[model samples]
Target: MPGRLLWTLAAVMLAAGLVAVGLGLRGPAGPPQPPAWAATARPVAHHAPVMARSVPVRVDVPSLGVRAPLVRLGLEPDGSVQVPAADRPGEAGWYDGGPTPGERGPAVLLGHVDSAKGAAVFYELGRLRPGHRIEVGRADGRVAVFTVESVERVPKDRFPTRRMYGPIGHAGLRLVTCGGSFDKDRRSYQDNIIVYASQTAVR
Candidate 1:
């Protein structure tokens, strides 16, 4: 119910924006489409070997009240990270581009705020406030707790890469998800709201 509460508010904002956009685009006649080009299959290039490290076993955030299992997955063909299922779904894996959680770098955890079917694990993540706690349990029998320092919503197009992936003085964590108004045509949220937390206590 806590997760749904936040999602409902987001949905309302999306609905209102859609109505306004629909009213504004009343008279629109677009140009005709160009001829389609022949589709050609390109050879897939070999990539460097993935660092087959074990995935974090679980995540616990007492402040926002979350404790759930986590799973690791590779990137999809479209370059977007896969979203874990909402009901009894595993945690969405980290983007290989970033550091692993608990390592001496910035680790990222992404999830769907809410899928088409229902509330996702991170539906209430946007509600987290500064000074909250986020604990990540690793398969190595170690747990990392990060203290929330800040939370901000940034446009997807203008996501602060340096801030998210840049070097931090110490181990850090970032929680990301699609937020802001949902565009029906795009079928995706317009912006990404990220919560930045850093290691405060580890056990």
Candidate 2:
């Protein structure tokens, strides 16, 4: 791809959706980062429904002091995920294509590491440590509580699409944002920071 087109797509990916932000491209950098599954050996639990279906209204990461409203996001025409506008960079968005929080599958959420203004939502996402609690408020008057499992930084070229999007027979949540050093030349980050969490309780 041409440099200009690559730059444009990077902008759209990072500024427009979580797919690109979670999946980083491998450039002249070294070997590709290992997949999240390979990075951890703990088995994901398979459980029956713990809560009813409902749209996520807010995400609260008390450890990061983050409390933001969630906007519903869908895929773009090209089949890529859509992200919130730059103007609303402080807000996070839930991918409508996947399972809703507290549901049976992975619920994906995307947010900008920062906007032109300053720090945006998920700026501290990478700081979230294992065992930290993540609470997602649902429209059905329930809150989906998840416990951080693992955090992985992977290159986009090796994005684990099938694994991240695959059905697991249980409730899961994936929080994604751009990571790695920003390449001024490429106008994008070289890696994606992914926070993996599994539903523990809902009320």
List per-prediction Cα lDDT, in the order shown. 0.56, 0.72
Model 1, 50-123: lDDT tens per residue?
22234577888786566777776444454444445444433544655556676766787766555434555666
- Candidate 1 TM-score, true structure as reference: 0.68
Best by TM-score: 2
Clashes of each: 0, 5
User: All predictions: root-mean-square deviation over Cα?
Assistant: 16.5, 7.8
Whole-model alpha-carbon lDDT for candidate 1:
0.56
Instruction: Output the lDDT of residue 165, model 1.
Output: 61
| lDDT of candidate 2 over 51-102, digit per residue (tens) | 6679999999999899999999886887577877777877899989778999
